[model samples]
Target: MPCHLILSKLADKCPSAVLAVLDSLVEPPQKTVNFKPKQDAVKQEVDHNEDMIRSALRAIASLNRISGGDCNLKFKSLMSEISKSPMLWDKYYSIRNE
Candidate 1:
C-alpha cells in the first residue's frame, strides 16, 4: 500500500499518531545561500519539498475528514507550517475543499 494510505488507516485507528507523523513530515523553512552553479539542483530540491508538503497536507485533510473534523486541533502546528508559504496554504485549502 502507498505510504499515505497506511497513514490514513493509522489515523483512523490512532488519531494522536497523525500529529507525530505530520510533525516529522512537515519541515520548517530553511534559508540557504544558493550558488549559481547549483541553481538547477536547488530548484529540484524545492520542487521535491513542495511535493512532500502537498502529500502531508492531503494526509491531514483525509484525517480531518475521517474524524469528522475532530482532528483540527492536531493540525495546528502543521497548518502553521503550511501557512508560511502561500502556495502551500492554497494547496491545503484546495485539498480540504475536495
Candidate 2:
C-alpha cells in the first residue's frame, strides 16, 4: 500500500501519532548552505521539496476524508504556512481542486 493509505489506516487507531508523523513529513528539508551548490543540485532539491509537499497534502486530504472533516483546523493551519510561498500555494490550490 502507499504510505498515505497506510498512514490513513493508522490514523484511525492512533490519530495523534499519525498526525505527528504527517506534521514532520510536511516540513521541507533545509537547504545546506556550507557549500556552493550546482544549478542542477538546486533544481533537484526544489523538485524533491515540491513532491514532498504534494504527498503531504494528499495524506492530509485522505485523513480529512477518513475523519469526516475533523482535520479541517489542521489543514487550514497548514494552508496558511503553505500560502507563504506563491509557488507552493499555487500547487496546493491545484491539488485541492482535484
Candidate 3:
C-alpha cells in the first residue's frame, strides 16, 4: 500500500508534505492494464479507484499495526480491496485462510 493512501485516511489532518511523500510511494513495479473510461461521467469511477487505493492502504497499515509484521504485496492488494467493502472483507477473510 502507498504511504500517502494510508496517511490520507488514518490521519486526514496530515500535511501536504505527508501527502507528497505518499504520492511518491505509488511507484509500483507491476504492469497494469490501461483502462479507458468511455465518458467523462465515468471519471467518478476513477475517483472511486483512488478512494479504494487509499482505503486499502489504510487497511494494510492497520493490519500491519495489528500483526506487527510486513504484509506481502499480494496480501496488501487484497487487503486494500477488502477494506473498501465490509461484506467483501468478511467474505474474503473467511475464505482466505481455508
Candidate 4:
C-alpha cells in the first residue's frame, strides 16, 4: 500500500509513472501444482499464493481508480477467482484481524 500511496501522489504530475507502477504490480501467473498426499500442506501453500495475488490485485485496483482505464475488469476477474476458491474471501481480509 505504501507503493500505492507513492504512485498515487506521483500520478497527478506524471501519469506515465503511474502506469508503469501499475503495470509492474501485475504478478506473473504461478504454476499450478497437484499435491494429493499432503493436502493440508498444499492448501496452506495455495492460500499463501492466493493472498499474494489478492494483494497485487488490490494495489492494481487502486491504481486503476486513479489512472482511469478498463483495467478494473482485469483485477476484478482475479478477485472473483479468489472468491470462488475454498478459502473464499476470508484470507484476503484475515490480515486485518492482526
lDDT of each: 0.56, 0.54, 0.43, 0.47
Off by over 4 Å in 3: 1-41, 71-98
Q: State the TM-score for model 4.
A: 0.37
lDDT tens digits by residue: candidate 2, 66-93: 4434455555566566678686667656
State which candidate, 3 or 4, has the greater lDDT.
4
lDDT for residue 90 in candidate 3, whole number 0-100: 58
Once model 2 is optimally superposed onto the true structure by TM-score, how far is the C-alpha of residue 82 displaced, in angstroms? 4.4
Candidate 3 per-residue lDDT over residues 12-43, each given as its tens digit: 44434433443333333111111234566577
Check candidate 4 and list the clashing pairs. none
TM accuracy, model 3: 0.31
Write model 1 residue lDDT over 1-98, tens digit each, in one string. 15666676777787666655654533321111111233557877777656665666666666655443444453565556557868767887997788
Looking at model 2, which ten-residue stretch has the lowest summed lDDT?
27-36
Candidate scoring better on lDDT of 2 and 3: 2
Candidate 1 wrongly placed segments (more than 4 Å): 13-38, 42-50, 65-75
Better of 1 and 2 by TM-score: 1
**Cα lDDT, model 3, residue 69:** 26
Model 3, position 10, has a per-residue lDDT of: 49
Best by lDDT: 1
